[model samples]
Target: MSIAWDDALKVGNIEIDADHKELIGLVGDFETMVKSPKSVTPRSIQITLERLQLYAHDHFAREEYIQAIAKYPGLAENKRQHDALRKTLADYIAKFEAGQFGDLGKAADEMAAFLNHWLMSHIVDVDMKMRGALSDEGWR
Candidate 1:
């Protein structure tokens, strides 16, 4: 699938929104990588996956920091969600590395679906709740 970033994913905060955009781009890059496993080397695939995972971790931290600064009441819940996301990513990576998906192409499709769905839903259902955050000051 041709996954592209959309403005509808914005969560009101500029920093958070920017991270979401980058995350979407990373997901797209990964989707492309997995779609054509022949054109990519194993090392290149590893690098792309590493970037995706590391960037996600960094984004979660940055988002939580912004929420903390704004004194968001849902900060605790947000952190819990972040923890779940991290765990889910780790589990999927482990499965992929262990050859649990049978083939790279199948794994690719599953990963893309999970990343796209999880990111979109989290941003919409959870992060969007902070659109009118209490304290309402600049978080940057």
Candidate 2:
């Protein structure tokens, strides 16, 4: 599937929205790497997984920082979700490294779906709420 960024994925906040855009791009890159015929190797997949993990960890930190600064009421719940995603990614990587490529396709597909749902649900539902609270508090 083509994972292109669109306005539909935006959370209506410039900083977080931009981060989300870049995140989707990285995800798309991973998808491309996974689908490449000649270039698809275990090493390449490992690199993609590493990049995704790094970017995602950084993004989650920034997002949580924003939530903390804004005193967002759902910070705990949102962090639980973040922790879950991180754990899942780590588990997937561990499996892949254990010579378990059989489920790589399915894992990648699930990752993409999870990301899409994050963009749709978390962005609109949680991020938007946090953004509104921050804006109302006169945060730039």
Candidate 3:
């Protein structure tokens, strides 16, 4: 299943919301590549993962910076969650590089599910808090 970006994912912060939209688009691209007849390869998956990781790192930094500027109370927890996601991505990349997951299709499915869940939950539960704080400070 493809993950579509919609109003439900918006967090009221323009930069973060734009980043989230890009992230969702990247995931959609990954899904398409994985499900395509001639484009699904381990190398392609690795490249997609790299792109997602890079974007995620940048987005997290931006979000953290905003949180710091806004003095958001949930900054620490947000950092923790970001760290956990980074670790998870690193582990998955290592496993993929080591040929641990024999089935690319299954791995792709798992990755899509994990990313969709993480992004949605983080946006709703964690990011929205930052938005609230920023809005209160007239920063949003």
Clashes of each: 0, 0, 0
Looking at model 2, report the run of 10 residues with the lowest lDDT sum.
131-140
Question: 2 or 3, which is superior by TM-score?
Answer: 3
Tell me, by lDDT, which candidate is best: 3
Write down the TM-score for model 2.
0.78
Mind giving the per-residue lDDT tens digits that candidate 2 earns over 102-134? 665665665556555544454556555564555
> Model 3: per-residue lDDT, tens digit, 105-136?
88788877877776676676777766556653
lDDT of each: 0.77, 0.69, 0.80
Per-prediction CA RMSD (Å): 2.2, 3.1, 2.0
lDDT agreement of model 2 with the native: 0.69
- RMSD from true fold, candidate 3: 2.0
Clashing pairs in 1: none
- For all predicted structures, in order, the TM-scores are 0.86, 0.78, 0.89
In model 3, the worst 10-residue window by lDDT is 131-140
Give the C-alpha miss distance for residue 54 in model 1, angstroms: 0.5
